[model samples]
Target: MPATAYDAKGLLKSAIRGDDPVIYYEHKRLYRWIKEDLPEEDFTVPIGRAAMRKEGSDITVVSYGLMYHRSLEAVSALEKEGISAELIDMRTLSPWDREIIFESVRKTSRVVLVQESSKTGGVMAEVSAAITEEMFDYLDAPVTRVCGLDVPAIPFAPPMEHFFLPNADKIARTVKKVLEY
Candidate 1:
């Protein structure tokens, strides 16, 4: 659910009212970082729906979890450079919203996927493959991914972990490269 502030309640509700087993990932780093005033009334954010975090015309950035936040930072930087980037928060990855992704890609003609997982066989791989298979003709540039290094595990040291994970600079650089292509 992108590990955002608004997702905690919805995730809890989904877990409580599950027809099947549901697995939820909570980012510990966001525990103190994200806070929001949610609606008092009961509600359930539908599963399998992605959220359009930002809209733009130049390029599309698809991401989930903490990477989604990082992508937004990159998008902000790109905006200052006159590169409008559409950011999509992939709330649910299992049954992701391909329609939204395709629509954005069609409009922008360029895409950059960001994720914290390893570059090898990560969620971005599946997403990039789907885009290539379904929307190759619509793309102006090859799909690019800003992902973690292909390592056995994330490093415990802050510096090493920073280097291992995808950050705003990496995302911004990749987006610029795609736009320039």
Candidate 2:
């Protein structure tokens, strides 16, 4: 199974203890993240469960790994404009928590998926398709994706890399567009 983890501690522990073989993809950017709120005793986040980062009524934003960090920034900025975005960090991709994702979509009626991969194909596409397929009736607007540029590879130069990858402004803009629909 292919799994992803945003939290430095909780999800890592869960993956280590799971019986199934897992290909865990650790985001390099998240390696330095320090979580000060962990429990005093050992704990583990369930393998198939996603952690809800924030709750809102206007829209749902789904992402994982480093993209989750970027989406959080965009969601916070949107909040200042009075657009509420519910954020979900998909802790595991293969066995993603559909119940949480579907419930959020049902309440918000709109969703914006973000990923660091190119716009052509990725986990974002799969999740977006699943939402449309299973919760089509609940949606007020079509599911939207805010992903990286469709380039062969990310640019080596720092400046171009900024443009190639999914960032906060891009995500915020896409969320606003979906909200306007």
Candidate 3:
């Protein structure tokens, strides 16, 4: 069965009440979502690890999941506009590589979180809050988030799906605004 908001709420309640480790399915998806390119002997890519896609002094694009691919494309487009962006793929969410993100934020001081979720109370909120709370002084611009508008995702129609997801154009625009701050 597909996950629902109710299910997530119940899971959280149970975990809190029980106070025990809960191996959530969300973790499994990231672990196996993309086929590992590393050697078989060293199969571990290390969950909670952050990998840098590009290095730049202008701005940093932080993203994960399918959004990670989209950010890379945006980086290419931004390059044509004479904007250099560094992309970081945060594979694991729970044990996210805060050190990597903090270091990059301290260096560039501009961050745009790209996530394919509702803009309201989404995972991007947590990231933005953390950055502001922990590395506020390092930032030159306000941390911005590029997320799908508050709407449900469509399964079949291309146009509807497009409307439900954050595209490269939206990301590029958000990045430009962040740079201006």
Candidate 4:
């Protein structure tokens, strides 16, 4: 999920009726930005499945939450530069969609994982590890991570917060670096 309001209700319903615990991380920044019309009937988006927002062949960009939107922006920029990027939204972070990720990497031969969490021990670390362990032979370049700085706490000021967080520019830069490698 891209942390949009469209799937919020479904995620909530899934959490309530799920057999095991579900940890949903709501992005505070998306609260005011994302709005959508949801279905009137009750629905649940299953956990552990990733949504492929865009299809491409050059590189694969895997992300979740706010970073997913940012990754799309970066993908758009890359598209302008003649680089096709496949964007995947890992809705469930705990049980990430390994099948989709492996397939994309196998086809594109390059990948970059974007996240807003701190770089140290962030979710991307596990994703990178998985790719290295399972898809090493498919990779043309090393897995790149576009993540927040290794800060103890997020900054309160807008400027500082922007600096600490991963944005489209940062993601695009990382994608370019990975492509060059």
Candidate 5:
């Protein structure tokens, strides 16, 4: 499960109680950078459901993990510029919330998928393909992706890493590009 700080407690508890094996990922950078309040009582977030971060009509932005936060930044900027971009946070990859995603696509008719991984064989590839296959007629433009460069591995240097990974600016640019179509 790719969980946010707010969903950490609930997702962790859900993972522990589930029957199937699960791999929970926690971004080290997020530990100190993000904070959220949790319910006082125990709770669980369904493993297959996604969270809708924002709603809009112009376009849809789908992302996960750290990229989800970056996408939020891009969405906020686009809002300031009078572009309304709906944002979806895919909490789980294997069984992503296709209903929510497809619903957003039906409304916006355009989408940009963001990921920190390379463009090739990344999660976005499968997602884009699914959208094309299942919601092709609903689309007004081709699905776009804002992902890391196709280098074998991201560089360690801060400047190189920033250039290689998908950031807020990159995501916003891609979103705007898709919106134009």
Candidate 6:
């Protein structure tokens, strides 16, 4: 069997065992299947925590994994438009940074969650639910999420991948829309 086939089997096995929350990051690069890069040796990356990337009073953008990088790019674009967006990168999802999100939402009263997964039953839904449950009273505008369309995996083509995935420009537009709301 090929390596790709073997990897597919391993993923299925892991999912069945439910040993760990498998982080399935899709490849954006067309015509390639890239594996996640872990440290060369066994090392510790503190999970279930968050890092503050920016400080601002206007609005906060919270995301994890790929969306974290996309959110940063969106914030950079927002800055060019005179809207300083504070970004919080949630390194882990299960034990997300509720304190950071809550405080930021309370202070700014506005938030936009940027994610790469499909919106339906995706991470963005959980984030929106958390904010509304915990900080609804503090919100000035409704919480919003910018996520990919609920479509199947992209084809091994550059144009197809670009169309299927959420890009920085799309994220920036979403943030701007939320700010206007």
Model 4 alpha-carbon miss at residue 30, Å: 1.2
Query: What's the distance in Å from true for residue 51, model 1?
Result: 0.1
Worst 10 residues of 4 by lDDT: 1-10
Report the C-alpha lDDT of model 1 over 1-181, residue by residue, as the tens digit.
5467777778668767979777787777778898889888887766788999999999999998888889999999999999999999998887889999999999999999998889999888999999999999999999999999998878989999888988999999999999889
Query: Per-residue alpha-carbon lDDT of model 4 for 50-154, expressed as tens digits?
Result: 888899999999999989889989999989999999999998887889999999999999999998989989889999999999999999999999999998888
Off-target runs (Cα >4 Å) in candidate 6 are 1-45
lDDT of 1 at 142: 97
What's model 4's overall lDDT? 0.89
Q: Where in model 2 is the C-alpha error above 4 Å? A: 1-6, 33-37
lDDT of 3 by residue, 1-181 (tens): 0022233344444444555564543323334344433333412244456778788789989987678767888988999999999888776566678998889999899999988879888777898999999999999999999998886554448887776788898899899999998
- Expressed as tens digits, the lDDT of each residue in 1-181 for candidate 5 is 4648767777778889999998887777677887787678767888888899999999999998888999999999999999999999998888889999999999999999988889999989999999999999999999999999999876999999888988999889988888877
Q: CA shift at 120, candidate 3, in angstroms? A: 2.1
Question: 4 or 6: which has the higher lDDT?
Answer: 4
Could you tell which candidate, 4 or 5, scores higher by TM-score?
Answer: 5
lDDT (Cα atoms) of all candidates against the true structure: 0.89, 0.84, 0.75, 0.89, 0.89, 0.72
Could you tell me which residue pairs clash in candidate 5? Answer: none
- Highest TM-score model number: 5
TM-score, candidate number 3: 0.77
lDDT of 6 by residue, 1-181 (tens): 0112223344344444665665544324311543554335433334444667788778998876666667787888889889988898766566567888888898899998877778889877988999999888999899988887787764559887677777888888877887888
Worst 10 residues of 3 by lDDT: 1-10
Deviation (Å) of 156 in candidate 2: 2.1
Q: How close is candidate 4 to the true structure, as a TM-score?
A: 0.94
Judged by whole-model lDDT over C-alpha atoms, candidate 3 comes out at 0.75
